[model samples]
Target: MANRVDTLVATSPIKCAADKFYNFFKLNMNELVKIFPLAFTGVEVLEGEEGTVGCVKRWKYIIGGIPVSATVKIEVIDDAAKSITFAVLEGDVLLLYKSFKATLTVSEGSAQWTISFEKSTILTPPPELYIPLVITICTLVDAFLLVN
Candidate 1:
């Protein structure tokens, strides 16, 4: 099966719109993505540009023991349309959804950012997959206990 743009979702944990979310993620992108690193552990950034290396940031991500790795070469394009275009240079799954470019537009303190993810299969396999049903139920129970 050929890799394609399989899934895309916009999350407003803070209810920020396009430009806001773009800037938010741009500033805190590293921190936000750190969640995945912490979850799986043994992940490392072998090489990457800190940020904005002449309009392009090169990022390299490696998960320990996983045969797959990703290197995204992101570039910001300021255009008449006022949107940023992010692209993946070379890495795993390049054939299936190799690049992603989107724009962030602000609307009432919330930004509507469109994230386009490329994938070969609808079932995009991760290195480690875990079921969260039990954990979610336990978390709800704990929250209820705190509330009551």
Candidate 2:
């Protein structure tokens, strides 16, 4: 049987401009660990350079009150569209997923997060837990940008 791919999308309204919000992730991702220590503990570039496609970054983040790390490759970056896609290469997330990809898109007044994945098994639950994390990150980033 062919594997089924599932998708989840969550959107949050933001106070910052789309380009500014997008640039924060594209150009200043490394600063996330320091800016939001409660949500992210570390962000390291394992290969390539920041904001470039094919770059690899390992992110240590908290979800469900537990710390988890994910190593992802920058698959696509569309500046005009204000979108970035990352493919999970390996990490704690792979333990429950056969494959995982995340895409973030910024619009005029909102940010959207999309997750596309295949489960390791039929019994494995979907990654709904990430919705709140995305929302929290969006809220924090928007506030930070508005202040600074």
Best by TM-score: 2
lDDT of 1 by residue, 32-128 (tens): 3344443332323335443342234334343343444444444664533434545555565355454554434334333334556655456655312
The residue ranges of model 1 lying beyond 4 angstroms of the native Cα positions read 1-13, 16-20, 36-68, 77-82, 98-106, 113-148
Q: Per-residue alpha-carbon lDDT of model 2 for 20-137, expressed as tens digits? A: 9999989897877877899899888999999999999999998888999999999999998999999999999999999999899999999999999999998999999888888888
Cα lDDT of candidate 2 equals: 0.92
TM-score of each: 0.43, 0.96
Could you tell me the lDDT of residue 101 within candidate 2? 96
Deviating ranges (above 4 Å) for candidate 2: none
Q: Each candidate: RMSD to true structure?
A: 8.7, 1.0
True-vs-predicted CA distance for residue 114, candidate 1, Å = 3.2
Instruction: Tell how far residue 65 is off in model 2, in angstroms.
Output: 1.9
